[model samples]
Structures are given as structure tokens and as C-alpha cells.
Target chain A: MGIEHDTLVAISKSWGLFYLIALAIAATAYALWPSNAKRFEHAKNSILDDDDKPLK
Target chain B: MPQRADAAALSYRDCVSAKIKCLRYYRQQKKRVSRDRVSLLFMGDNDMISQLTSTERQYALVILVLMSLCGLVMAAGGRGDPLGVHGFVVLAFSVGLAFVLISGFYAPQPDPEQQTQYYDDPTKVGIALTMAWAVFGMFFGVWVASLLAWPDLTFDQAWSSFGRMRPVHTTGVIFGFGGNALIATSFHVLQRTSRARLSDQLSPWFVLFGFNLFCVLAVSGYFMGITQSKEYAEPEWYADIWLVIVWIVYFAIYLRTLARRKEPHIYVANWYYMAFILVVAVLHIVNNLAVPISFGSAKSYSLFSGVQDAMTQWWYGHNAVAFFLTAGFLGMMYYYLPKHAGRPIYSYRLSIISFWGITFFYMWAGSHHLHYTALPQWVQTLGMSFSAMLLVPSWASAGNALATLNGAWHKVRDDATLRFMMVAAVFYGIATFEGSFMAMRPVNALSHYTDWTVGHVHAGTLGWNSMIVFGAFYALVPWLWKRESMYSPKLVEVHFWLALAGAVVYVFAMWNSGIIQGLMWRTYTENGVLAYSFLDSVEAMHPYYIARAFGGLLFLTGTIICSYNIWMTVRAGKALATDNDAEGDIPVFARNAVQAGE
Candidate 1:
């Protein structure tokens, strides 16, 4: 019931690299996208303040 | 009426009195179980029974009862085996927990207004458990290190042998001390970052206690000579299964809390924690696929054998370090380092770049552990190349942390807590570079089975992982308990020096000894035959082993002092009840205004 070792390696060498690289690109794009800059900026400063009370 | 008895039994005067007695009782009870927040939680009268809704408490009781029943069955069915002993251990543990729950079962429900505030009782318990495990783990560490130096310290017992206790020390510190710290800080950071309380009350407790149960099983199993013999993945089949169940609940809690976040974007720390949790689950399940000889036996055989088995083991081993030790702590550094420094992260963009970089590179670098072994040469080279690539992301995060301390240099000098984190970053950089260098083909030939590898691991574990944990504890303990600071700042300074000295001593001793040992093994006489006997190299290791043990003692001493400092701080909080820090967490979104996230 076990798969062949060479087959597993071949698939990992091909599809695995592609999947990982694509994910990396997507993550980087999400980070550097211009419109999202404000959100990142706000999130950076979010924990610094004492105005953390839940909305009444 | 039975549930209300807990409240009735623990009045204000009675609690204060017990608090006084508990602190006195705590030191003596350290060798066995107790001295954790569990006892302290029950002793406190303020919001005592109201933290959990009645239904949640009953939910916990039912689960505990079922768990205890399972333990009883195991104990009965596996009567002649070591599995039976573990079954009794589980029964004691679960039944003890059940009593705590049943005692609080009939208490009044928590106020609806409490839903508005962040739930932190679990975090409080987690910190206590972390320190308890720290002491428990490091005690074994020092004992085992002493065994190496002296070799006759084994007190005439089967359990005291080095084979069993080494895993105890590793599993203890890694899962016990480090894992509990990760869970505690994750809970605290998740609430403040997401501006949401935990989604469900019972599940957080489930995750926390359940994870501890797995740690207990792993450590105790090693004591009883029950292991699957994988380096880090050693806790046989059943304990592994229990961990899987606990992990899924943990991840679900994280996802649920994130789903209810008030912010538009998830923070960087949560990303690291997510990777830590998600990747560890994958690593664990894949590496631990084994078949038991029978339903009652504590033994199991791995699915793969030969080179594939070795590769799989190293892949799991190396990545456990990647996800469990490195990534989780980096997630912690992302939050606590910046928060403690009172500065924003140096570059949000760098955080993103490094996060993705680490995520991509670390998964493939495990093959480096199998270099010069039976693993394929091509795979080894791939591992080496990827390990070298890891330096970029590793240094990126380390630099990001150090850079964020740019304007806070004065705090780094004046505040010992911040200095702990600063030194952690420096060591993180040093260790990652050392790791990449050692993974190369030529270097691996010298360093593969030598003390050099041990030195590198300690440099990472002691310097990076343990230091950052102390930093987080120093920062978070005060905030969680509403105290102004640690019980004694002077002791923190003392701890920093001791820990630094310990790590330096341990790592350097190993480096010198490792090179000598490696050189001796590779050396040949003028007649082209082997020069030194293996015993000569072993005898040559005597002094360095002694030095390493002394270093570990220093580190363990510092940890003991830290535990005392934290314990006194908890006591200090109880004494000056109103000398409180502000209740600062993330602000949840309002009902009517810009509907960003709920």
C-alpha cells in the first residue's frame, strides 16, 4: 500500500516548489500592497495606547 | 448547594489566610505536584467562582470524568504492563482536576458584563504552570548534566539512568516550560491584538490543561522507560494521539478568536503563532504514524524503515526546532519585544518579508540534520543550501528586533527585562549563522556527531528560547497580575548575568571540547593509522563536562531565583490589592460606527 520513493520525490520536487513559491509571492504582495499601508500602520501603533477598553 | 460550598468554604478572611499558608506551603510542595495557580485560583475570593459560567464548569467536569474513566480502563486492561502505571497516573491527574471542577460546579454564572472584557484567567494559570515546569524541567537538566560529569550519580535505580532522564529534561523544558509560556503569551497577545476575548471560555482551559497532560505523559513515560525512541517524538502512540487531540482544540481556539477580531488586518505575531501551531500539527502527525502491537501494549512500530525512516525522523526533528523553538518564540518576540520596548516594530515590511522567508525556508532545511549519513547526497545538498538560505530570514527578524530598540537604548540599559530580550536577539543571530555554517558538507563531517552540535542546540535553546521566555514573564507577570513590576528588579539583573554566564560557559566549553574530540577522531599517526583511542577522547572530555555542569547549575540557580521573584510578586499583588496597573487591551469595535470587524 506504500507509494514508490522516486514518485514521491519527483512530485515534491515539482509541485511542492511551485506551491511554496506561489504562496510566498502572494504573502509578499499582501504585505506591500499600497492601499493596505494605512491598516498596517494602524496595527503597529494599536498596542501602545491605554485606550483599550471595550465599547460600552 | 454543593457548588456554592466552594464559595462558602473560601471567604475573604479564609482566602487571605490560605494565601499566607499557601506561600509557605508552596516551597515544600515543589518536589511533587501543587504550588501552581490551581490552588491559588481556588483560594482567591474575588471573582472566584464567577470566572466560569456554570455550564462551562459542568462541561469541564463531564470531560474530566470521561477522561478519568478512560484512564481507569487502561489501568485495568493493561494490568501487567508499564501502560498500567501510566493509566493510574492519568486517573490521578484527571480525577484531581475533576474534583476542582465539581467543587465549583454550582457557583453562580459569570456576569454577562464580563463578556465585554478580555478573559485572562487561563493566562494567569498558564504562567504559573510555565514556572512550575521550568523548575521541574531544569532540575532534571542539572541532574542529568551532573551525571555526565560524575557518571556515578545514578542513585541505584532503573529510572535514574541517563537514557531515560535525558528525554525527561528535553521534553520538560521544551514542552513544559516553553510550551506553556507560548500558550500564555499567545492568549494575552491574541486578545490585545484582535481586540477580542477568547471565543469560548471552556476550550481555552481545555487546551491549556490538555496540553499539560500530554507533557506529563511524555515526561512520566520516559521515567517508566516507555518511549517510541524518536529523538523529540518519543512518547509512544497513545500520548502522541492525546497531543493531536489537544493541538486541534488549540488551533480551533486561535482561529475562532481571529475570526472575531476587531482589526482589519491580522498582526504579525499571530501569523508566527499560527505557523507554529499549524506546522507543528503537520510535523507531529506525519512523524508519529505508528502501529501498536496490540491494543493494550505501550509499544509501537514506525511505518517507515531504513533511509526513509532516518529522513523522516530528521525532518520531524529539525522542524520541531524550527516551529516549536524558533517560530513560536519569534512570534513572542514580535509582540513582547516591541511592547516592552514601548516602540513600534522597526519595520512592518521587514516583519512581513522575514515571516514569509522563514516559513518557506525552514520546511526544507531538515535534511541538513542527516548530512553524511545514509540519506541521499542530493537531498543533503538541498538541505545544506536551504539552511544557508535560512540565515537571511533569521537575521532579518533578529535585526528587526534590535532595530526596534533603536530609540529605546536607554531602556535596554536601565531595564534588565528588555536586556534579556536584546541578548536573546543577539544569540538568535549568532546561533542561526553557526547552524548554517555547520550544516555544510565539510563542516558536517567534523561536527556531525560531536559536542559542537550540542553547543549549537544549547546556544539556541538556552540563549534564545529561555531568555525570551524570562523576558516575557518579566513583562507579562506584572501586567497580568496588576502588579507594578517584578517583586525584585535587582534579582532580574542577577538572573540576566547568571543566565548569560551559564549559556556562554556551556556553549564555549562544548565548542572547545567538540573541536578537540572531532580532531582526535580524524587524526592519524605518522604510520597512517588512527592516533587516539575513543577512550582518550572521552577522558579528554572530563573537564569540559564539569564546566558544562557548573554552567547549568548557574542557569538553574537563576531560574529558581526568578520563580521566587515571581511568587513574591504574586504575593505583593495580593497585599496591595488596589495598587493596580491599568486594564489595557485592544479596544473592540463599537456597534454603530465604521463596521471594520466585530
Candidate 2:
């Protein structure tokens, strides 16, 4: 039973890594999608504005 | 001729003004109609129709198919218990999911005003429910401890009665209470920090419903003796899966909000919250790697055994204490302490250093729990060393929090919430110091298998977790309900003293009893034979147990009083309506002052 459990654990570890990679890909794609492009532009403009603002 | 020219100019100005008015009215009407149409399509009737999107439908179908396959495997192995509660929970979850997806698809094109209030009221309800549950849990805990002390109690009877109730009390406080508080507050925090109302209405409800559902399943399953028997990881496979799903959504919501944040730097509190969420997810998934025997059954086998299993379990367990209990509360401390005290953090540098130190060291300290067991001696040594080293970061945080109150002592006197948080920091310092001491080999020899461990845990859980939770509740209720002050300041004072005195008595009594028991167990008759019977140690504990129960009762009483105080505040406390354009929710106290002046 111990040996069988160990093997199953190893399988799960590998599967988890794969799932993590998939999640990352999905997340990145979602962020960079066309619908979000305007948001990105707005964020970029805001960042530039911050660079110009004086320290509080 | 001059009069005619003046009249012509006035007529032209009037015509321009009328044209602009007509255009503005037309636009307003269009917006109103679109918003109404969207609301009808999304929120009108069936919640299910609102939740299910094409993508979500596909995901649910896949899960359903996979579950059926797993069910078949379970049937083949003659294990079929999980199919009952598990099936119903999954179906309910699917219905909720469908509603959210459909809502996302048809929801109005973001009216800021309407969206702002949607999650606002529900989150307050969640907070109130959480406080109620916590008080109930304390009552249950005191009851269980009393029963455990009863002389007439048989092993079977004791186990049957309190064994089930113990897990319920634990889960009720931790997941039910702590989980709700964290979820509700995080929603509020994330929104303010991000400078955006929540993205969607249905998602917040989904997260809230999913969390409560997990709690229900965990507590009920434990009573049925359906558990994996892993301490702190007792919830079986089905419940674990539900948490994973809920957690993923929670993570997404937080991330999406952060992506849209108006703040330049993610606030220190947010960093701590994110770490807690991310690390706990990793820990839960890794430690709970199990294969179910069937869909509806409680029986499942963890995929790690012997030393490996021990290692993995403690890794999950200690960190469960560290992240779930410690880190999350630390996030609350960072936010609420400063906000209530009206002071800046003493040192951002200290906060950052301690945060990193805690995250790094706590993972290694779990092996201390397995000291002197079948685990490797080297692992034990590492665990002990790391546990000792952990004091630096722990104290760093405690010191930083205390130091933040350097000029704010007056607030501590009048503000019961600040008092709770200040005491929580002190308890954190004491608990961490004791924890480090207990990890040493010499001390572990005396403390292991004794009531000392129990005392240590309560110091952390009751002293640290409960106090921090109380502080958060005090901070949150007024703000959430838009009230000026708590219903009774005197009751808050009474609660603080009661809880503090209870913790002190409880810990000191248990510590003394545990050490005496340990010494008695190891004592030898001058001729090199064991001197004390096991019953002798048991006999020694009777008085202490009685004292401990008294302590628990006091704490329980304090908690009940607190719940009442909060309930009354919600019911009859004067509302404040301070304008908050950027974040729609008014500061409760500020609003009250304004109303009073008016």
C-alpha cells in the first residue's frame, strides 16, 4: 500500500506541474486579450503621469 | 436698430442652450433604458440562468463526466458513501456556477452606482454571520472541554460525544468564522485599494456561497466520522475540491482587481493577504493529495505514507497555522491597527523583512511536530533550528505593531478594538517565544504528549487568532453598518478583561500541569524502575482541567457579550452618511460625527 501510494503521489506531482503551466498560459492570454488592450493603454498613460508628479 | 440687435443676440443664446439640454436628456434616457434591459436579462428571475456562461458550462460538464468516471471506480471497489452528500453539493455548486456565468454574459455595461451596493450589503451579512458562528464555536468548545473532564465518561461515550463536536468547533471558528471575516474584509480592502467597485455582482456571491458550502460539508462530514484523519486537513476529497474551486475564483478576483488598482504600490496589507491566499492554496493541494475510493464515500487514501506522509502532513499543518491563522491575521493587523489608531506603520522596512522571514522559516518548522518519531533525526534538528530562528521575524512584526502605537496610547484606552489588536500582538510575541522554546530537544522531551502543547496552541489560537479576529470585527462592524460607535463601550471593556484573564489562567494552569505530568512520567524509583503510574499523571491533571474549563468559560462568556454588542450596534446604532465618491462606502465614525454636527 505504501509503495502504491508513493507512485500515485509522483503521478499527482507531475500532473500538478502541468496544470500550473496551463493556468499560467490561460492567465497571460486573458490579460493580453484584445478586450483588455484599452485598459492596458490607460494604465500605461497613468504610469507616465506618475513619473511626472512631484513627491508628496 | 440697437434694441433689435440686442434681442437677436439673446434669442440665439437661448436656442443654443435649448439644443444642449435636449442632447443631454436623450443620452441619459438611452443609458437608463440599457441599464434596465441588462438588469432584466441578467438578474430578473432564475439565478441559474444568470450564472452559466458557455465556457463555464463546458467546465461543469467536464467535471460532471470526470465525477461519473470516479464514481464508477468507487463502485468497482465497493465504496459508495461520498455519492450522497458529495453529489448534492456538486449539483448545487454547478447551479451556482451556471448563474454566475449567465450573469456575467448579460450583466449591465457597468453602472458604478448600482454595482457598488450589490456586494456591499451582502458582505456585511457575511461578517455578522461569521461573528455569530465564532461565538457559537466558543460555546461548543467550552462544553466539550467540560464533558472531557467528567469522571463518569466512558471512552466510547466521550469519543462519540466530543470527538465529533471538537472538529465542528474547530472548523466553525477557523473556516466558518475566520474564513468569512477574511473574505468580507478582503473584498472591502481590495476595492478601496484598487479604486474600483467589484467587477461583477454574482462572483462575490459565488465566492461567499462556495466558502460556506465547504464549511457545511467539512463540519457535517466530521460528525459522521467521515474524515481523512489528518489533523487540520480532516476534510475529505470532495470538500477539498470545492475549496480549490472557490480559492481559484478568489485568487482571480483579487488579481483582476489588483490589475486595475489606482494605487501605485500594492498596500502592505494586500501583499500579506495575497501571500496567505497563494501559499495556503499550494499547501492545501499538496498535503491533501488523496485518491477517493468512491464518489459518495468518506474513505480515501492519501498518496504519502510513513515518514513521507508525516513530513507532508506537518508541512501542511504547521503552515496551516502559519499562513491561514498567522499571516492572514497579520494582514488584518497591518490594515486595522493603523486605520483605527490613525497612525502610520512604524517601519515599512521591518514589516517587509519580517514578512519574508516568516514565509521562509515557517515551512521548515513543521518537522518539530514529528520530533522523536520515526522521522529522521536530522529533519528534527533542522525543524528545531528553524523554529528558533523564526522568533526574529515573529518578534520583528510584533515589535513593529507595538511601536506603531508609540504615541497612540490614548486610543488604546478608549478604543476597545485597538486594545484587542495590541493584546493580539503581545500574544503573538509570547506564543512565538514559547513555540521556539518548545521546539528545543530538552524542552520537547518534557512538553511532547503533555497538556503543554494544548496550552501553546490555545495561546496562538485563542490568544492570537481570536483576539485578532475580535479586533477585525470591531473595526469592520462599525464601518460596514455605517454606525458611529459600538452599542456599548463598557461591554467591550468587560470582554477584553475577561478574554485576557481567561487566556492567562488557562495557559499557566496547563503549563504547570503538563510539566508535572512529564516529570512524573519520567521519574524513577531509586532502584531504576518507573515510579509513577500513568494514572498518577492523569490524577494530577484533574484540578488543572477544572481550572482550564473555568478559563474557557470566561473566554466563551466574553465572546458571547461581544456578539451581543455587535448585534445591537447593527440594529440600533445611528447611521453615518459621509460622502465617499471614489469608494462609495462611508467611514462609519466620520459619518456619525457629520450627522451630529448637522
Candidate 3:
């Protein structure tokens, strides 16, 4: 017999959960990557440069 | 003998040049004085001058003429078709615009050396409107609370009844006060973070004026018994259509500005603002789909009837809170809190995580508001699950804000504005947690349709949203006016205590009253008999309602103080230059100090 409907529903739920987890981890990894460290640091301090002087 | 004669000639020449140099300096001073006199003719109000670009100046001239025309038409229309309360409001606003334009003829200069590079004038006006609305909204809220305490206070008119005044308070605070604050801060944050000016000047004014026009229509229509009966989406068909147009322009302005960013990466705050703008448009359009009874009439029927309509309205309702209040204010917090504390955000990564989580989850959680309704079980479950998941991001944002203040906690103690931001974050955490808990079906069974939900909303609006907004206002007003500090720090301190005490009293009174009401409703005796009648519960709530009114009064008093403080601060800035004047450097409050080589 084919898989029960409840079983299929359960699998979908778990899959959705797994997908979101993977996405979260990927986002975290991207943020923490060594290559991104400098770029992100620059972004954090970016507002400090917003002085009243004209932009070039 | 010849060498001695040449030396004497050289000495005579040096003496003559020294006298000539002194004469030239005196002549230059006279020329400078003449130039100053000429400049004074053009710059009557040096401090309050138009910062509009050339293109924007043209737009202002066109808008001024058009507004006057519209004002004349509305004035002639009286209470006739196409010009009811809407006409009067338009006329009033047009008069205001005319006054501004007339002033510009006399004082049409920008203090380039003192002002921000970006077009910040719109944001300044928006903040002023925000405070005006805040006081008015809080006054209505106090009135509504008093009416609940003593229903007889509503006079005799249907327009003055609790049913009517309730929406006035809600719409006034939500759209009038909170909406203006969002637009103002979003513009401020977007420009600073992007390191660019707004895309254009005219569109900002269009959005501001048009949006407020929608608010006026909504509120006046309510007083006139016009409604679609949807909470938070109560404005009838025409008002909704006007809002759609205004919102589209808002979104376009935001997107255009983002595209013009000098920075390579978009800031986290912009992402939140973008979401707020886009999602609100979607929600407003989808939930307000309706057919007007007639072109002239204000009545309309919602396109989706019965269960579908309920689901759609709540979807719009809950997300209005999610997007309009929470997301937008969170955007405000991310920028202002860190900037005010003079610290970088604790973790940019967490901001990313929370942004993604909240944006994705909040849309799904709207159904939680319809938990026990005719909505299907599975849909409710999905809503509850998403709401529970939302806790992660909500706490992340709150935690992120608190952490940003790690080494800058002294700022919170010393600066009332920073303290307001800190307390707002704390309240945000509390409200979000309570939101998830109440979403569960079991708890909703007890708390739904009770004052508990009301308490929870105030906890968010008063404790979270208003606190952050007050902080931004305090920071923004002085900076906008080119002042070193507020007129009185002691007043800020007093306002803070009043706000804190008011919120605490307001929230706890609601908690006690809401729980009691909820418990009474759910109570049953032996043989399946009800322990208390519905009227009994209402009677019990009388004292609590009065307490809530007192609490609202305190909050109202605090806001009035805050407004007074801001007004005096602007006056002080006009009277004397502070800070940067001594060194001829830009004021620290005007913009953040840039580090070396950055």
C-alpha cells in the first residue's frame, strides 16, 4: 500500500523544519566566513562616517 | 659710499610696503561687511531655510499653487459632494502649505555648512507631525479609558460614544503617530546607512502630505459613521484607494533611494523598512478589496464575506501590528539605539538572522488571531507554530539591542533618550513572549475577547513603540535644529519617570483586570452552572477600568512634557548656537564622528 496520508504530512513537516535549519546555518556560515570579516566590520562602522560634510 | 646709499633705499621701500599692506587689509574688511549686508536681505531666517533642490523648488511652487486651487474648490464645495470633512482638512493643510511657501520667499536659504548633506527637512516635518499626533492620540486614549470607567461620560451623541471614540484613539495612534514616526526615521536611517541623499525631494513631501490626507479621511469618515467594519482596516473604499496610491509612492521612494546607495551593501535597517513598506501595501490592498455602494457614498461591502473575510481581515490586522508597529520600530531601534549609544551593533549576523526569521514567520502567524474562530484546525496550528517560532527572532532583536549597549551602559544612565531605547527593547522582549503564549489555543480560549489582549497591545505600543520613538525624537530634534543638547535634561528625566510609571501601572492594571475577566468568563459551578453573570464581570472591571484611565492620563501627561521639552529645545537652538560653534566643527549630535582614515 501507499504511504498513509498522516505519514506524508509528518514527512512534509520535518522536511520544512530541516530546510529552514539548513538555511539558518548557511546564513550563519556566510556571516562568519573569514573572507567576509573585513566587509562586515566595515558595514558595522559605516554609520560613524556619516558626518555633516558633503559626500564626494 | 654707493653701497650705503643702496641699503638706505631698500629700507625706505620696506617701510612703504608695510603701510600699503595695512591699507589693503582694511579695504578687504569693508568689502566683507558689504557682502554680509547683501546676504542678510536674502536670508531672513538663517536657521530655518528651505533645503530643497532646484528641481524640488519647482515642485514646491507647483504644489503650492495646486494646493491653493484645491483649497478654493473645497472651500466653495462646503459639505457638498467630493468635499465633506475631507474638504475642510484639505483646505486647512493647503493654508498651511501656502504659509510655508510665503515664508520661503523671505527665507529661502539653506545653511549648507551646518545642515546634513541629505534632504532631512522632510524628516524634521514628519517628526513634528508625529509628536502632534502622539499628544492628540494619547488624549483620545485617555478619553476612551474614562468612558470605559464611566459610560455616562460619552455625552448623548452616537459620535461621542465608546464605539466611535475607540477607533479615533486606535487610528490616531497607529496611523497618525506611529506611521509618521516610521516614515521619518526610515528616511533618516536609510539616508545615513546608504551614505546617499534621498532619490528626490518632491516624492518625500508627496508621501508625507498624501499619507496624512488618508489619515484625516479615515478619522473623519469614522466620525461620520463610515466604515468597512474591519479592525485596523476600518477606512472605507475611497480612503483605502488613496492609501494604496500613497503607499505605492512610499515604496517607490524607498526602492529608488536604495538603488542610489553609495555603499555597496544594503543596511539591515533598510531591509526591515523595505519589508514594512511592501508588506503593508499588500495587506492594505488584499484586505480592503470591496465594492462601494455608490461613487458618492462612503459605505462599501467587503469582497470576501463570512469566514473568508474574517481570515483576510485578521491576516491584515495581525500583520499590521507585525509590520507597521513591530518591524518598522525594530528598524528604528537597530539604527537609533546603536547610534545614540555611540556603539556599533553588537552582532550584524544576529540582525540578519532575525530579519530573515521575522520576515518569513510573521505573515504565517496572523491566523493565530483567529485561533478559535471558524478557521480550520490545521490553519490555526500553522499560525500557532509560526508564532512560537517568531519568539526566536523577536528575542534576537531585543537581545541584540541590549548587547549593543554593553560598554555604553553609562550612556543609558546619563542620557534619558538612550534609557528610553533600552527600556523599549526590554518591553519588546516581554510583548513578543506574551504574544506567542496567547496564540496557543488553550490560552486563547481563556484570554480571547478579553482585556488581556488590550494590555498586551499597550505593552507593545506604549512600552515598546512609543519609547523608541520618544528616544529618536529627543535625539532628532536637537540635531535637526543644530543644538548641542536638549533645552532641559531634567525634563527628559521627568518625562522618562512618568512614562515608566504610567506604562507599569497601565499594564499591570490590565493584567489584573483581564485575568479576572477571563477567569470569570470561563468559570462554572456545580451542575454545569455559571458562577458569575456577564454583567458581574463587567461590574468587577469597573475599578480596573478607572485605574487604566488614570494610567493613560499619566502617559498623556508625560507626552505633553516631552512635547514641551522638544518645543523649547528648538527655540533654544534658534536663540544661540551651541557645541560646534567654539571650534567651528560640526556638532557631535548633528552626525557621528568619523574615525581617522575611514
Candidate closest to the true structure, highest DockQ: 1
Residue-level lDDT tens digits of model 2 in B1-598: 9777777776666567546645654564455455544332222122333334445445554654554454454344433464465555555555554554444555434432343342454366577667777877777778667766774443565344776778877888888888887887778766654555566554666687678878877877776677788888889887798799889888888898777666666666777788888999999999999998755466789999889999999989999988988888898888777766666677665676677778777987999998899987767887898899899889999999999999989989878789999999999999999999999988999899999998999998788888988887787777665556787878989999999998988888889888998999999998999999999889888889889889999998898898889877765454432333233245543333333212
Residue B106 displacement (Å), model 3? 8.9
Give the range where candidate 2 chain B is weakest over 10 consecutive residues by summed lDDT: B40-49
Against the correct fold, how does model 1 do in TM-score? 0.90
Query: Using DockQ as the measure, what is the rank order of every candidate, best first?
Result: 1, 3, 2
lDDT of each: 0.85, 0.73, 0.80
| TM-score against truth, every candidate | 0.90, 0.76, 0.85
For each candidate, what's the DockQ?
0.47, 0.04, 0.32
Off by over 4 Å in 3: A1-26, B1-50, B53-55, B61-83, B95-99, B102-116, B574-598
Index of the highest-TM-score prediction? 1
Error of 2 at B326 (Å): 0.8
In model 1, where do residues sit more than 4 Å from their true spots?
A1-21, A52-56, B1-38, B41-49, B574-598
Q: Judged by lDDT, which candidate is best?
A: 1
Tens-digit lDDT string for candidate 3 (B265-342): 887888899899999999999999999766555668989988879989988999999999988998898888877777
- Listed per candidate, the RMSD to the true structure in angstroms reads 8.5, 11.3, 8.6
Which is superior by DockQ, 1 or 3?
A: 1
